[model samples]
Target: MKVLMVSWEYPPVVVGGLGRHVHHLATELVEAGHEVVVLSRRPTGTDASTHPTITHISEGVLVVAVAEDPAHFVFGEDMLAWTLAMGHAMVRAGVALGKPGLGDGWQPDVVHAHDWLVAHPAIALAEYFDVPLVSTLHATEAGRHSGWISGTINRQVHSVEWWLANESDSIITCSVSMEDEVTELYGPQLPPITVIRNGIDVTTWNYRQRAPRSGPPRLLFVGRLEYEKGVQDIIAALPRIRRSHPGTTLAVAGEGTQFEWLQQEARTNRVLRSVTFLGNLDHTELLSWLHAADAIVLPSRYEPFGIIALEAAAAGTPLVTSTAGGLGEAVVDGVTGMSFLPGDVEGLTSAVREVLDDPAAAQRRAEAARERLTADFDWHRVAVDTAQVYLSAKRRVRHPLARPDIPQRPLPGR
Candidate 1:
């Protein structure tokens, strides 16, 4: 199968789990004897004049990273404008790749879109090529805002998500909770939605042996420092955790808009000295911390699927996560790892205490969680399931009544 994937984030431009998800899935697809082409963007601040579009082969997959058009659009200041500009560039590259003698004359049997960020280009390219459009709605704007789309940007983003969900021939979600959320937000007339849990490369994230520690018991939190991520709740629970296990320290990894706010929260809760902000760490640094920490806590209020939980599990690190959205499924409460309700500071403290109190039990749970990876969360299985979805989408598009009629215009710069 010839698959074309459109995503705003890919390797060297990874902002979150979505990029890593795409990278692993695309590589696995290539290994499965399928031709995969990824249409992505160059990193910000990259000179477009010198490298307008970079085409390279990585792990048997062809990646075409296009440079953003020279438009005065700032992503943080105006995300919608920046996204549209990115879509324009992607469409130009896709058109060029399809033209005979101009490029490789490559055409995809299916166009897979990662999220709403690349919805416009994905839709345009799918329609332009007269192929099936498969989209994976990783998370919804309403879900992120806890069912409130108040601001203009929030509403705009929600609308775009709805449009993408409706436009797709088949939709894939990472968790059952996310599937329900997507259905509640944009349903009844939406395409077929499949729940495919996010996967990890377990071999690369092998369990690490820890040495005896002497200092404070270390607790690690690895993820975006966002309100929805519920980092504040961890800081709130720190005082209680310290009372039970004295000299317990919380190390926060990853950066976001809530950095300063979380720090202030720690100070307000009188645990400022115990909380350490380690900022963002690369994969190697992250794994080092994961292996070194006493336990990894994921206190998310709204998670599509806790990929971090899988990472921690892969590293055989004891996990104490909240049962929020897909996290409920990701971490089987008390079985795979300790879990609690979202935003429950007391519960968070209790769960952490359980891990610190019974180190042997925690290790047993971590081993069980790691064992579950091969059965449920392997990248090879994910690629196979995704390929099935693509086949289903192809069948849907081949139906005479289901065929989409999209008007095409002259290519840009023609």
Candidate 2:
């Protein structure tokens, strides 16, 4: 299958899990014998001479980076405009490919979009080419703010999400909870939705077995330092954790808008010195930390799918995550990893303590999580399943009267 994937984030321009997910997904699809083309923003400041760099990644995959000028627009002044410009650039790239003898004269069989950032171009190209449109929504704006669409920017984002959900021929979400969110928000306008859990390359994380640790037991948080991520909850729980395990330390990886606030929170709670704010680490450094840490913590208050938790499991590190959004479904509470209520400081403190207090049990659980990862969450399996979704979407588009093989939730008030 020839697939055109439109995403705002991709390698070298990655900001979060979305970029990593798309890169890996596209690569795995290539491995599965499918032709994949990824359309993403070109790295900023690329020499204008190389406006569109089409990178040939392996025989089956290609990445096209379309450049845009940042000087023309303000960052915070107009993010919606920035998003639309990126989308327009992707459309332009697709149109350029429609010309014959351009890079083997290939065209996409289906248009797949990740999130609302590329919705405009994905929808337009799918319609222009008369191909199926499949959109995978990572999370909803309403869910991120806990069901509130505050600020004009957020409202605009939510509106875009609604438009994308309605326009696509088929939809995919990372978790069942996210599927419910899309159904609730988009109502009858939503097309068939598929729930495909996020996966990890287990071998990449299992590079080295964790060695015995001495001194302070390291607790790691690997995500954006945002309010929705619940990094503050972990900072709040540190005081309680220190009362029992005084040698414990928390490592905050990944940079975000709330970095300064997290520093303030740690200082205010008197655990500033115990917390190591490692701004952002590359893939190698991140895996090293994952392998060395005693436990991995994801205290997200609104995660659609906890890819970090799966990474920790793949790394054979014990996980403790909150029962927020898809996280509740991702981790098997008490069996695979510990779970705490979202925003419950006390609950988080206890969950972390449980993992720390029982080393053997924690290791057992981590091993079990790894087993699950191998059995169910391999990227190879994810690619095949995703291919099935693409075929279903394509079939439905070709036959309007046909029903989807994957049962879709009925639209509200049906």
Candidate 3:
């Protein structure tokens, strides 16, 4: 199938799991004898493109970019507002979605939008070309904040999410938990939502598994340091964790608004020096650092299925987390790692200490994690599953408006 995939991030411009996911999905789709084209924002660490967004092939994936105007951005921000100007810019740029007006034989069979950032473009193109529109809803405000969205921004996010789901031929989410949330909040009429849990490219991530180790047993946290992420809880847990396992060090990664609060928590606990906040390390650096850790911590207060845990698993890194939302589905508890009550500091600390203090058990869990990752979470399998969802959407599109239950294939990438 000829598929046009739209996303806000690609390659070096990634803000979250979504960008990396789009890249690998596109690449593997091409590998499986499918024609895939991607439209994404310009990423950092690349030569500025002469075109609005440059087109290139990375490991067989065909990609194009359209640089949104950065001038409209707020003062002092380095990155473009992904969703703020993306919709209008994407519509204007998608004149090239299919065969240029020159009448090239190529045209897309499916219009796939990765998230809210690209939903507007997907809707516009599908409308213009009369093609199937498939949208993937990565996260919703309610799901992101444990059902605590309010005011104008909250309502806007909620409305846009509803509109995207309602308008699309079909909807895809990263987890079953999200699908339930969508249906419960938006009603069953909000298009059939299929679950395709996000996947990690295991080959790149496996570097951490095979990497050489150096120092004391370590604890790692890699993600936005924010209130929703439960970073403060992790900090509070650190005092107990250190008391039980003093030599263990914590590596906190990624950047966000709660950074100061997180730092203060670490300071108040008098473990600031032991906690290393390395804001957003690149892939190689991150993998190398992952090797240095005993287990990866994703103590998110409301994680809608974590891709970081998938990577950590692929890296043979054990996990310590709160059983918040879809995250519980990601790990098999005692098999892949251990979990605790979402907000219990003692439980969080105990879960971390379980692996760090017990070398034999942690090693057993780590090996089991790697096996689970390769078996269930491979991107190739995820791409094939996603392709099936696209085919189902295309079938629905061909029928225009059909019965809501058309025996759709199971949601992919779970």
Candidate-wise lDDT, in order: 0.88, 0.83, 0.75
Query: lDDT tens digits, residues 1-414, model 2?
Result: 999999988887897899989989999998888889988877654533665556556445688878874335544577887777767777878877777877566778899999988889998889877889999999987787777765667777877888778778889999999999899887664689999988888778763445666887899999988788999999999989989988799999988888998899999999999999998898789888898888888999899998989888888889899999888988999999999999899999899999888888888888888888877788888888899988988524432322212212322211
| Residues forming the 10-long window of minimal summed lDDT in candidate 2 | 405-414
Candidate with the greatest lDDT versus the true structure: 1
By the lDDT metric, which is better: model 2 or model 3? 2
**What is candidate 2's local distance difference test score?**
0.83
Enumerate clash totals for all models, in the order shown.
0, 0, 2
lDDT over C-alpha atoms for residue 195 of model 2? 90
> What's the CA error at residue 312 for candidate 2, in Å?
0.8
The model with the greatest TM-score is 1
Residue 200 Cα positional deviation in candidate 3, in Å, after optimal superposition: 2.7
The sequence of per-residue lDDT tens digits that candidate 3 reaches over residues 1-414 is 988888888885788888878888888899899998777766433333443556677787667776755434541252225465666666666665545562254478888988766767888878877788988887776666567554445556666676677778888888888888778866666666788777776777764443343566688999887677888888888878777676678899899888898888889988899899999898788888777787888888888778888888777777887898778888878887889878788889888877776766877777787788777777788889988988887534332333222111322211
Q: What is the Å distance of residue 210 in model 3 from its true position?
A: 9.8
Output the TM-score of candidate 3: 0.88
